[model samples]
Target: MTEKQFKKLKYYVIAITILFVVGFLLWEHLNGGILSHHLMHHSDYPSISNWWGLLILPFLAWLSTVRIEKRVTLQPDDAPVKAKILRVVLIGFFGMLVLSLVQSLSFSVGYESVAICLSLGLVVVGLFLPIYRAECIFGYVFGSIFFTGAIIPLIGILVIAGISWFSHVCIKPLVFRVIRAQPQ
Candidate 1:
């Protein structure tokens, strides 16, 4: 590559790295206060065994956004769309199932488990799926848009939900087909 191209690439990579680093620092600082209260504070650092738990949130965020710039290109036109879609769906479904159970146990009286599962399913699916803008759309929004007549009568809400589901579910089949077409 030319020197100019190399320089530009370096600049962009550096900028992105710095952004993630600062984000990590900010997240860590906030989580530090919460952890200090729940686990141990800077004052209690001497008394605590390991205060590193405070870093977990920032670590997660860092992990999530490591290559955020490339999330779109993470999967390509030539990629295995079906497998990718299936994986995302399965994972999203499981997460939704758990979220449903939690919601049920919290609000309802006797049908806690059932309610929880249903609630979790809806919420988790919304969360796992991302829209064109890469936003997570939860069940309340999902059901409202896609299953409008059935449950979600609000079009605005359903629109966002549909986008999220579409993002998650839409690409998989395409990827799968492309992969299958490749010569062995």
Candidate 2:
């Protein structure tokens, strides 16, 4: 896909993300979780909604490229290559989900430190994974850390969000630049 097409596709994926979040909330509400409470605060375990989101996320990422490819299939493009990238991203998402689940379960069992450490570890792994595979790394790393901090009340959310924003704005690009500069 061309850059313009990719930009359009990003908007589509953003829309899908918004819808996924909304659907998650709806699922929570239907299951009797608080509508007023944030979705992350609604549970101690990885929500089914989250699993659903992760399951579809790869498909959406791949499909966006597929749509563009169908319209413009002439170039010596690497759209097909996106399949592997999205799959790796999906693995990262699944890893985060499992780790978050373990963290939540640990919190319920009064092993909060373990949960935080696991989250911190996941963040570190996420930091490296993006150097090799940038697709959805922010969501993987940030989402995992958020789960770790989610149990810490308001301060936790603020801290994780700050870290995520900082990494996204400052660190990720530098890593990408470094990776791009290295021998292929």
Candidate 3:
């Protein structure tokens, strides 16, 4: 990818990540700091919001993958994403299931922090799956889930924003430098 493209992708990732972090904070605060209380208490069937979140996972994966593809100049063969939509959906489903289980366990165990840690584990799974399996959607969706369980949503959002900034401003250029220094 050209330097220009890399810069553009970096900016886009930073902006989108910040937006997500802020949006999650607002949603949690407005809803009394619980992300899926409706699912936990009000409804047996998953709501439209739940399905909507799931549906968007593939699109988010596509966005992040496309950015990485261009930034790193990956050959089509270097990273193949087959059955892209289906894979993202299934992984997202698993993350959701884990999230639900953790939530339920939290109620029984009376420890919300433990549930949050498990939920963050789901996000880590989502993030790494994209790196190895060439599926990216899980990261965003699971990230939402991770932030959902945050004891202090504002702090979580700030941390996420900071990570985005650090990755884009510091890590991105360092990676390019490393790649340039390597012998072809």
For every candidate, C-alpha RMSD to the true structure in Å: 15.0, 9.1, 12.1
lDDT of 1 at 67: 34
lDDT of 1: 0.39
Give stretches of model 1 more than 4 Å off: 1-53, 72-115, 118-184
Pairs that collide in candidate 3 are 61-136, 61-137
Residue-level lDDT of model 3, residues 1-184, one tens digit each, is: 4558656765675567556656665775687653542434347754333324433544444555565545345434333353354356456445544555555457546886786676466445433333222222234244444433322222333444355456656767899999999999
Q: Using lDDT as the measure, which candidate wins?
A: 2
Overall lDDT per candidate, in order of appearance: 0.39, 0.52, 0.48
Quote each prediction's TM-score: 0.25, 0.42, 0.31
Please say which candidate is ahead in TM-score: 1 or 3.
3
Which segments of model 3 are wrong by more than 4 Å?
1-48, 74-110, 115-137, 140-164, 167-184
Superposing every Cα of model 2 onto the true structure, what RMSD results?
9.1
Q: Model 2 over residues 1-184: C-alpha lDDT tens digits?
A: 4667767876786577656555664675588752332344456644333344444444435554454445445445576775655566567546645655676678768897897797677456544444222233334333443233222322343355456656777898999999999998
User: Residues 41-115, candidate 1, lDDT per residue (tens digit)?
Assistant: 135433321133223223322433333324424556544663564356445434533443344334335654675
